[model samples]
Target: MKIELSGDTFYPVGALENFLPQIGRVVELGDLPIAVFRTSDGRIFAALNQNPHPKGGPLAEGIVSGHYLYDPLYDWKIDLTTGLVQAPDTGRVTMFPVKVEEGQVFIAAAVLQQA
Candidate 1:
């Protein structure tokens, strides 16, 4: 599982840590905006929070599937782990590396260099 550190800042992308127990939330890492999802199965994904094909508000933009979200606007699946734009969409979004320290989540700025 990918452990994405996100709360209000960006961090480095050094592989990843373990997953956490969460219901998912929005995180701000530097200039990179992201959404962190902690699956019920303990799987974590950090996908680019932007919806190239947005359906509406941040809460109503895409469909969650495992560690990826299916962009509702273009029928594409975005990988939160690598921020990889999969089929239905060609362009990829930004993905930042994250980790949780203590009880708060942290983002690595190095991972957002390309974002």
Candidate 2:
């Protein structure tokens, strides 16, 4: 979680509902491939998510369960809260900061771009 001040950086603000609940997808904010999703409560988050290994499947394509998602690529279950790969504690994804505004989703652009 490295955050630094930059003048060229921009944050995104949008409605959480626009993202749709119970569904997940990979979004590219500038240059980052973020796995964006809304919890059962409609809260959204953006993270540096990807499936480990070249299984020809995306981690974002898995079914999100609570804070984890079942990676369809190799049937591996991942915990989103920690971004840790289950069955082994050595794997994790880089998660970014996300904030919600008045009916919108806000994200740190420079960070996403770097991811």
- Candidate 2 global Cα RMSD: 4.0
Residue 88, candidate 1: C-alpha displacement in angstroms: 4.3
Q: In lDDT terms, how accurate is model 2?
A: 0.63
Instruction: Name model 1 segments beyond 4 Å from true.
Output: 1-24, 30-32, 52-60, 110-115
Candidate 2 ranges beyond 4 A from true positions: 1-10, 54-56, 88-90, 111-115
State each model's CA lDDT, in order: 0.55, 0.63
lDDT of 2 at 92: 60
Model 1 lDDT-worst window of ten: 12-21
Compute each candidate's TM-score over C-alphas. Answer: 0.57, 0.73
Q: Model 2 over residues 49-110: C-alpha lDDT tens digits? A: 56654443465667776767677667776666666778853456565667776776776665
Kindly give the stretch of ten consecutive residues in candidate 2 with the minimal lDDT sum: 1-10
Candidate 1 Cα RMSD (Å): 7.4
lDDT at 48, model 2: 58
- Residue 31 C-alpha lDDT in model 2: 55
lDDT of 1 by residue, 5-39 (tens): 44444454322233333444665556555667665
